[model samples]
Structures are given as C-alpha cells and as structure tokens.
Target: MADLTMARLHEAMTVLYAISLVFYFIDYLNKDAKAHRIAFWLVSIVWVMQSVFLGLYITETHRFPILSLFEGIYFYAWLLVTISILLHCLYRVDLPVFFLNVIGFIFISIHTFAPNQIAQSPVGDSLISELLIIHITFAILSYVAFSLSFVFSTLYLILYNVLKKKKWTKQWTRLPSLDQAQKGMSSALLTGIPFLLISLILGLQWGFASFDHFSIFDAKIIGSFISLLIYCLILFGYRKGKLHTTMYAWTQVYAFLIIIINFFLGSRLSSFHFWN
Candidate 1:
C-alpha cells in the first residue's frame, strides 16, 4: 500500500513536471513572463515533493540514497531540480533551468519506471545493473523525442491538407502556422537524432559487455539503426530541398510508423533484449 501510494505521488509529480516543461517551452519561444512564472512555481512544488521523498527515504533507510543505482538516480534528479530552482530564483537563467529540469525529469522517469525488485543472483543483478538501466532510459527518451516529432509532423500534414482544400475552421485557426509546425518537427528530430545515436552506442556497448552470446544482428538492433537512418535521411532531404513541406511531413509519419513497429515487433523478435 505504501509503495502504491508512493508510485502515485511520483506519477503526479512527473505530470506536473511535464506541464511545467510545456510552459517553459512557451516562455522559451515567446519570452512570456506569465508562463515563466507558472513554470517556476510548478518546479518549486516538484522540488518540495522531491525533498519530502528524500527525507522519508533517509528516515526509513537510515542512509543517504546513493548506495544503489535506483537511489542514486533519484538523488541525482533531486540535485538537478535543486540547481534548477536556485538558478531560476537567483540567476534568472531561463534556458539552463529549462534544460536542467529536462534532464532531471528524465532521471526521475527512469527511477519511476524501473522495476523495484532486486535480483537474487549475481548474474541476474548484473544483467539489470546501472548500464542496462541507463541504456534503456536513453533509448526511451530518444523515442519520446521522435514521438514529439511525429506529432508535429502529423499536425503539419493536417494543416497542409486543410489549407490545400481551402477549408477553414475555428479549430484549424488555433493551430500554429505551417512554418512553426515545420520548425517544431525539425527541432524534435534534431534532439532525437543525437539521443538515438548515443543510446544505440550505449546499448550495444552494454550488450557486448554483459552477454556472452550477444548478436549485433539482433532484430531490435537492426530496427533501431534503420529508424535512425530514416530519420536522418528525412532531415537531410528536407534541409537539401529534396523533400518539400508535404513530402517531408509524410516521411516523418512513415518513419514514425517504422519506430512503432520496431519498438514492439522487433522487441519480440530480438534474442536478448529482455527489458521488454
């Protein structure tokens, strides 16, 4: 019951943090003080919640939460929130605070989703150690970025079709302009690419280091690389004028489909990608 309660609390905190990120993004683009103020207060609430959790953890465990990988991740995230809050209040550095909270949110997500049970055997523990956890976190985060890209691209396509058809509605009017959608998609792809590349590198390294029977030709491995390639090519095509607005948006939609397939079917087909 306690664990379940804690889990719910953590989920709530994450949701608030995500909403804060949306406001921060708005402030980043528009320099809206109201949005910034909302983000600051939201983050401040998150920090207080995290601090309470940390206190409870220390009270129960009688030690600082740095001894285990899970505890270490939580503490790291807490430190990031702390720093972001200090920066927001003291230095007024909006960009750094936004980014710091992003990283913090990622780490908190890692801690939240990771399984709570420790393995009984040494091999079992080793298989699910820090390296594996970090690899999975990076991969998931990359997918998150790609999913954002897909959303914006999908929006772009919808807007293009509506405009092309000369159809105007109140709902359509609320949507950002085509150029803004294009920029959002491009920005998400730019963020996703580096994250996906790094994740692949780290995942491969973890696999090779941990598994004696690891195969580079694993389905997940192949699929991940293919997804990365397709995204990169789409970006290149757009930048080089080989792909126009509609075409580029279409490619992103198709590429995102590939990602969905790879994430699910490829996981089932892979030999040792056990974190499914």
Candidate 2:
C-alpha cells in the first residue's frame, strides 16, 4: 500500500507538470487573457504538487537529488520557474516564466514515465550516511536556487534585445519595463551569487573531506566556476553601470548552457558528484 501511494503521488506530480506546461504554452501565444488567468491558477496547483513530489523524494531518498543530468535540468527548471513567477507577480511583467517551466516539463517528462530510470536506485528505508546526506542536501538546494536565478538572467537579456532593436509589440509588450527588468535581474543575480558562493564553498569542503585532495578540478567544479566568473562579470557590470538588460540576460543563457554541459559531460556527474 505504501508503494502504491508513492507511485500515485509521483503520477500526480507528472500530471501537474503537464498542466503547467500547457498553461505556459497558451500564455505564450497571447491567445486569451482568460486562459492566461487559468494558466496562472494551474501553475499554482502545479507548484503545490511539485512541492509534494519533492518532499516525498527527499523523505524517501533521505538526500538531495543532484545525481544525473536529467535531475539537474528539471530541478533547475523548477527553480527558474518559481523565480520567474515571483518576478512576474511582483512586477506584473510579461516575462515567460511559464515557457521555461514548459521547457523543464519536456526535459523531465521522459523520466517521469520511465520506471527503469526511477527504479535503478533503490534505498531500503535505511538511514543515509550523515556526511553524504549533508553534502547532497546543501549542494542541491544552493545549485537549484542558482539555476532558477540564472533563468531570470536569460529572460532579461531577451527583453533587452527586443527593446534595443526598438521592436515592441503585443507579443513582447507585456514584458517588464527596461528599468524594472534591469533592477529585477540585478536583484536575482545578487541573490544567486551568494548561493553560488555557498555551493562553491561547500563543494570545496566536500572535496577536502572526502578525497583528502584540495582543488578537484572536476568538470562540475570547472563549469560552476566558469559560470561563477560570468556571474561575477555581470555583477561588476552592474556596479560599473555597464550591465544592460540584454547582456545580463544573455549571460544567463550562457550560464545555463554551461550548466547543461557540466551536468551531461562534466565532473558534476562523477562519483564525486554521483550520476547514474
């Protein structure tokens, strides 16, 4: 019965994600305001179910899920979507937070139905080691938060470009004003930098603790550092008043791409990081 319940709960999470994706798509087309409102409500529902899914995963696994590229993409996607939604609500901007969620849904959807993928790792309700648990817990949360903020940076760039070319229309008109977008991105980066710093710090600490070697130079670390460098530049730009919205947004896309690279082909998936 417990097994069945977990399975059902997982299924519901997948369905909720599908609903979020659909709503995001409808919003993208600028089809109907009524539909957009409905989409908003659907996103709220998905958020709740998404939380439940995460709660169950943590309770069952007793650790963070930063294992594979698939998990990274999806986890980061959730973070990005939530931040986008928050910014959307706070600024009443037309940023496409929903579109990113749709993208994340498609990325994670494959695994949702793949029991083989989900079943490969089985923990028999035993307590996970304290060190491993702590390592994974802090790492995944910080990384996920940074990932979401990264997405916001990307959106800011897009809106900036449209504004740069002086191409405003009903399609893109709903985006935040340039001033708001600039400030919003700065705020996000400000928040993300601290998380990135923490992840890096914790990662270094883990390396020294586990391998007795300092400076692992693993793919994940290198990628993360590169992403960090870019983010630092973005911050510098902001301070120097050189960070325009489009550039900052592009920085986000670039960072996310690097994250994808690190997740799939980089060291973050190594046994050091663990990816099946």
Candidate 3:
C-alpha cells in the first residue's frame, strides 16, 4: 500500500512536470510572460511534492535513497530540478531550465515506471563503503555535468549550421547565441572534469581496499580512463587551437555516447562492478 502511494506520487510529479514543460514551450513560442509564470509555479509545486515523497521514502527506508541505480537516477533528476530552480531564481536561465527539465522528467519517469533491473542486487549498506559511496556520487555528478555539456555543444553545432546556411528560424532567434553556447559547453566541461578525476581516483582506492584482488583491466575502469583521456584531449586541443569548434562539439557528443555505453554495459563484462 505504501509502495502504491509512492508510485502514485511519482506519477503525479511527472504529470506536473509535463504540464510545466508544455507551459514553458508555449511561453517560448509566444513570448508570453503569463505562460512562463504558470510554468514556474507548476515546477515549484512539483518540486514540493517530490520533496515530500523523498522525505517519506527516506523515513520509511532509513537510508539515503540513492544507493541503487534506480534510486540514484531518480535522485539525480531531483537534483537537476533543484539546480534548475536555483538557476531560474538567481540567473534567470530559462533556456537551460527548459532543457534541464526535459532531461530530468525523462529520467524520473523511467525510474518511476520501468522495471527495476538492479532490484535483485540492490546496493545494500554492506556493499557500500564510504569511499565507494563518494566515488559513485561524484561519478554520477560528473556524468550529469557532461550530459549538460553535450546538450549545449549539440545546440552550438545546430546553430552553427543554421548560421552557415543563412537560415534564421524562430529557434535560431530563441536559442542562446553561439558564443553563449560555446561558453556554457566549456564551463560545464571544466566543472565536470575535476569531479570525474576525483571520482576515478577514489574509485581506484575503493577497488583496492574492498576487493581481495583487483585488476586495472576491468571494463569499467578502462572505459573511465578512456573517458578521462578523451576529455583531456578535448581541453588540450581547444586550448592549443588545434580543434575546430564543430569538431570539439562533436567530440563531446561522441565521448558522452561512450560514457553511456560503458555505464550500462560495464557491469555485464566484469564481476567487480556487477549489480546483479
């Protein structure tokens, strides 16, 4: 019964988010302040409801609700919403808010509605050391930041193409300028790479401490190293004026794809990181 109630709350939150997204779209298309205001209030209401649900979940479970993959995804979505709200209030970054909410809603909805693949081996307290917890947290955060960078980079590419063709659509006018998008992409990468490096370092430490035997050849570890190297090259290339802007953006896209694949498939290839 409690589970049913929580599921209902999750659905309600998703519905509210959908409505808010629609209002944001309307505002963006029509330049209507009323719609924008409505969207803001709706998001606030959804945030409040999600907070209540999270509180109830934590109280009932007696644990932070981010241990398992499913819970972590949901919590990440909540963090995005929180960040979006803060950006809205402090910076008035409505365009980023729109993109953030779209991604957040998709993730939260998936966690709420999809079958739980990690259920059989849910990340129990016994399996989670302090170092492991910190590693996972920072890794997830770094991925989130990288995902945002990819979004901005993709936008930059699209805008670049539109400008190259001398075609100015409403989207071109509504979207952030090319320079703004490039700056945003760079800022997100700069913020994320440090967290990724720290996560990798802590992950190695945790692996060494927890496992009776550890190997650097593990699929996840190898993928993480590759990801780090790719980003490092991107930074170096950009700084040295060796990488074209379009190439840099596409490289970020490719790197993010590698990240997604490794995150989802690495456990299947190695026992050390297996969830089930």
* Top candidate (lDDT): 3
**Model 1 stretches astray by more than 4 angstroms:** 3-124
The RMSD (Cα, Å) of candidate 2 is: 3.9
Question: By the lDDT metric, which is better: model 2 or model 3?
Answer: 3
Residue-wise lDDT of candidate 3 within 1-276, one digit each (tens)?
A: 987877787788889899999999998787778999999999999888878878887898787776666777777788888878987898776777788888888887887788856544435656766787788789889988887888788888888998999988664466778888899889988988999999999989988887788888988889888898999889889889987679989988898888878777875675667433
lDDT of candidate 1 over 119-206, digit per residue (tens):
1123233455566656666666676677657767877888889999998765455455788778878987998899889989988888
- What lDDT does each candidate get? 0.78, 0.62, 0.82
RMSD after CA superposition, every candidate: 7.6, 3.9, 2.0
Choose 1 or 3, whichever is better by TM-score: 3
Worst lDDT window (10 residues) for model 2? Answer: 119-128
Q: What is the lDDT of residue 23 in candidate 3?
A: 96
Write out the backbone clash pairs for model 1.
none
Query: Once superposed on the true structure, which residue ranges of model 3 sit more than 4 Å away at CA?
Result: 120-122, 169-171, 274-276
The CA lDDT at 91 in model 1 is 55
Candidate 1 has an lDDT of 0.78
